[model samples]
Target chain A: MSTVSTSIAPAAAPARTSAPADNTSFSVDFSDIGRSFTAKPERGAARGSTVAPRPVLRDVSLTVQPGEVLAILGTSGCGKSTLLRIAGGLDEPSTGSIRIDGSPLNGIDARCAVGFQEPRLLPWRTIADNVALGLPRRIGRAEGKSRVAALLELVGLTSFADHRPRAVSGGMAQRASLARALARNPGVLLLDEPFGALDALTRLKMQDLLLDVHAAAPTTILLVTHDVDEALQLADRIILLGADDDADDMAGGRTGATIVQELVVPGGRPRDRGSAELAELRGRLLAGLGIDRHGQARGVAATHTIPHFPY
Target chain B: MTQTQIPKPGTAAAVRPARRPIRLTSRRGFVIFGGALLPLAILLVWQLSITLGVVSVSQLPSPAMVFLAAIDLYERGQLTLYVAISTQRVLIGFAIGASLGVAAGALVGLSRGANVLLSPTLGAIRAVPSLAWVPLLLLWLGFGEQSKITLVAIGAFFPVYTTVSLALRHVDQHLVEAGRAFGLGGIRLFTAVQLPAVIPSVISGLRLALAQAWLFLVAAELLGASMGLGFLLSESGGNGRIDRIILAIVLLAVIGKITDAVVGIFEKWANKKWA
Candidate 1:
């Protein structure tokens, strides 16, 4: 934890100069957050029938320090994305509140910028214009233009500024999406599987790019991803969300997901992927997600070697 | 390796050099010539039929007779007046109708309350043949430009309204959400996301409304009006002058095609910009 804090300090320092006043990284607090969605009635069901409210997230409480990168790790449908959405104010919690920098979040909080899994770019707009959409309403035209240009440069998409979203490759489009989210200099950036759609090689490159972006902006990041290696790679802290078996039994079965495991990743920015420590943590996280390690845990050498090519 | 590299540019030059120049001028000329082929063939067949005496001259006048009728109308100075009046009415009616369609479509498309309140009644009104509005409009506004233009406007409204509202409603939800997330709402959101997303559909709607405008113009002129192509057709029919009737029809076809071509050009530009 101390190492993590020391590592983030250097990155957070430059963020103050780069980001607008009072718009730098802000702390996020999720206290007793619970969200329930009413299940749609089945077809041919009687009219005016009341349906039970299905809980998706219950009692999800966490406090993220400013400039911290927190990864919410969970399997699909485990309400991790829901938690991130609640923090971004894109979705409201049924119970409890989310406070950003000590202020309670309201509808679509301006302090938070969300990068959705899909690029969600306006198809007609150029990459530059799409990024400009994130500019604050009061920003001057000249300042906004420079900000968009700077963001494109940051994302290494300056050459493709005039290109439409469909004209670019998937990785390039995702980079533009990230740049757009950063255009507002968001106090808290919520990323929901931002690179989930990319090919493996591109995903690795994007993860590195994200680390660089964090170093530059250092906004409080809440990333929700199902990829355990991704969590190990990018997070200062990793929180695993899953159903508590005992609590689930008491609630009659699978009520909602809450924090099941939490770990302070034992390193700074750009941690070594091949480290034995992370391999153990990865095995543990995969187990938490009900995935078998297949004798791949730390200190367990493979009995059979991978065959060489052209063998 | 040297031979491959040397031949690469040779092949590229062979493929590229003539393609652009050909596409620029001669290809376009070829397309235009191809388009005219059918009409020219029809003209030949009509002239041959007349020369062979396949049909009576009184029933289907020779192509020359139709040309003479057009010249007669032009010499009398009525041809320009008729075309001018018809074009003016169609343009004005289309403008008023398309503007209202966009306004109403945006309202209904964006707001649930507006959609619920307006769409049902508008849909019902659209079902009524626009020609049916003529009798009521004549009663309300009398036998004047008001009644005729109103009929054309009615004709132009539905297509634009339907297309605009549907397109706006179906503008990608993800894009709208992203727009909303970035502090855009109301009119800013509309212009930034919703409007541009649906521009192709709106232009298509405008084109359909223009065609409908011409259709309604003829309907209005056929029932009333002292001038215009429809008036010319009806008057010539009454006088048993088939040539004049045929001339009015050819004039209507040419004018309609010209107007549609104008909108088609605009559509091409818009699709390039927005789609």
Candidate 2:
């Protein structure tokens, strides 16, 4: 058992609503985001010629209502992670801009906390100390310690407080990562495939944990993932990036992803795991990726059904 | 069938459990005895060779004779004094060399400009043998304690420098990113993340440097030293006191092992704590 009292207020519980109640919730706005990297020209190019920039994302625009769970679904190399990074303020878009809570984001947005694909826990530090890392220096030591204890308890890892990360299992470490991210009490949480590395059982459990966490805090979430089921399971809205039809726009250069489909997931928390609507949404997401159950085009609505498999 | 059944009444089919054997000795006792076996065997062979007159007394002394020589030195208060002198010289040399090496390594590791400017020279210096420092140090510092200490210091420097720099450069990238996400930067990042990460590597380097320091102590004492084990060995050789020479060599080996064991314990503890 942790030294913290059980009455530490369950993480500022916000009512489950479509819109943020007031100024307490943070909103994210991505306006015409595009990113590119310059690639050197191959041999035999003309002298003094400027090489073209390889576009990873282009014309991506979206908005996350405060306290909404928005899952960005895309295949590999579709720049979903890059978009998340841009939103988190760890990266800058080559063009366009992002605004958080009606304020322009220039550097790291102190109100936003990011959980990466890897747990990224410091190996030398105890699990408790690693969780404490999320708190800013402004938080007093006693306060920070209590907050860390509360988080460890919330994550069901209070017993392992003194243990180093190497001593824990992978799923436990990922839970610790979640606890660390929440330590800042950020209004916006950005997760990049946080459960991608776990097994099937662990992934399902983690999804449930994420829902529990969101219910307790009601912070806005932006999750980037390739897993269709995961998006349908947790998201209030799903945004599909890098539609197959957009490839022609590049004309043999580099093609970037854009928001091709925006979906509003119906129903509420504790929804059926094998719900028919979720299965339909999963099918639709797969079809949006230009593949059907038989790996063929879905109906006659598909022209560029075969996504370009990058060599 | 009836006769066979009746015959089993005196002999029970189920055997009683065998009484446990009485304990003969503890495992540690056996381990110590096993460890001493090879040394005892070698001593026996050495004594037997001397008794059989296979080696002349002038050329090689028996184990008993060396024991007498050790006792003689101990009674004269010379053994402890010389050992103390040699130990102190090595300790001081190692302190200077190791501190400088670590400082230089860290500077090079943290700054690209420092690495580019200093690595070439340091690498070149590392290639120079420990024995090679004796002459230059003698010429520069003259025949005194300074030259001897410098030789040992040179021996201790290279390993620590190499290990520290390499470890610093190879800190896990993910850990750095994690630190940055938490608002750690600059010196705070280094202390909180990088320093602890490199401790295990630095410990290994210290162990290597300690061994090298011991190796160089003998060479260091070979230069114009009136005391210490190395000087004792040389002086005893000049006087054809083979027993004393053998005792010095044994003492050096035993001391080296003891020091290395101490560092080994530290290494194990650090690895368990940090790794």
Candidate 3:
């Protein structure tokens, strides 16, 4: 075990030194991001058929400033998770480039940590060990131990440090997951519906916990959620991915997901829920999601009355 | 959905304690007592039938006759020697076969390359019964300890290998993704995530393999063993000592049952730990 720790020490050394400067150096840039795959044709289409390429994400361009919380909202099948995965360097975009801290991302983005929808805790390991997984290899044992303890405390899972993931509640498990993500002290934190599976009450608690964590860490966050209210609550800006307007622009009768609308939230942290600004923006965002209360294509028009919210 | 407080429908019933089920640990004595009842009743019927001449004493000896035969074998020191010899063979064979099976299963389960190269060949060998291996093994290794032990090992290997490999393949995908997200790859991922996840299944496989090992032991000893319980059984059959044959059969069943119970205990513990 000593030998194993020593072997990993050198590989993780740079990350430890670079972590403190995270907030200033952190930014995520997604330029002309496009991903497509060749899938088999639908079952009823034809026998031995070769279908056109299916594009999941297309022309998704955005720059997330350091310490900013950007929410990507869309319905299922809109490739919002795919966009986050690409940003995290888990998957590569077929058409464009992603940059982290102004450098082009080539492989797994060590500086960007991801929290998936499921808590994704390893069932065998204790919560601390799962959290310790993100610790850089080069850090000494003492430092790693301290960091893990601190993170568990930060996520309010100090009592569960020695407990396995299976022994903890779902909300607690997700908190451990958040602690694990923060363990690396990554410059960019990519969350793909981190609270989607929780109960409404638990989701609210987690959203509050996320706010507290951000206040402490101040890292750039990219949250992917379908919940309009959640985006209004947590994000400084919200981007919607959907089909392009022009039928001619859509190949194979349907277009890939793109950044069709962007909304800049008006209020600061801990804003009132009953505020009229948020209420009107919520209506416009809902309309953009194709649920117009007026029963017409008035999504763009709805946001015009909200003076503070910018597109 | 009205909030009227008129004893709120099933509130009284819901608040009442349901009938408490007996816990397993607390019921251990009861379980043992219940289990012994059937065998005791069978033994009584056997003894009564023999006394009444319902079962011919020559063909089907009473339970007392078998007990006396066991004591006779014990006095001659044959009982201990036979049991010891058979047990040593099983322990050695099980150790060898179980280790190899687990290693092969891990290799094949974790690697598509190993599965492609080795699965078809292993699958064919696995299909061959323990009895089928007896003749070939005897021809190769002779009517000695080697042939019998090898036969037992072969019987034990297939179940462990097949169950473990299949279980490993079916490990939850969500856990695998979690491992990947945490910078775990290759061997680390397998050990930290996949292996622990499949431990319950592996323990179940071990229990099955152990049972298979014992089944093959009898077949192996019957073909050629000079001092095993199986040998005793055959020798008694030739000598027409029906009681001694029954004694050997009873000993085999008792040992098999005890060993299976031991493995079952481990299986239960593993499931609790890894559940």
Top-TM-score candidate index: 1
Model 3 chain B: lowest-lDDT 10 consecutive positions = B4-13
Candidate 3 backbone collisions, by pair: none
Once superposed on the true structure, which residue ranges of model 1 sit more than 4 Å away at CA?
A1-23, A41-49, A250-253, A296-311, B1-26
Which residue pairs show collisions in model 2? none
**Per-residue lDDT of candidate 1, residues A57-133 (tens digit):** 99989988888889999989989988988887677888899888888898888889999999999888899999998
C-alpha-based local distance difference test score of model 2: 0.81
- Which 10-residue span in candidate 1 chain A carries the lowest summed lDDT? A1-10
- Could you estimate the TM-score for every candidate? 0.90, 0.84, 0.87
Best by lDDT: 1
Superposed by TM-score, candidate 3 places the C-alpha of residue B184 at a distance from the truth, in angstroms, of 0.6
For each candidate, the alpha-carbon lDDT, in order, equals 0.86, 0.81, 0.81
lDDT of 3 at A275: 70
True contacts kept of each: 0.73, 0.50, 0.40
Fill in the DockQ of model 2.
0.43
Error of 3 at A300 (Å): 16
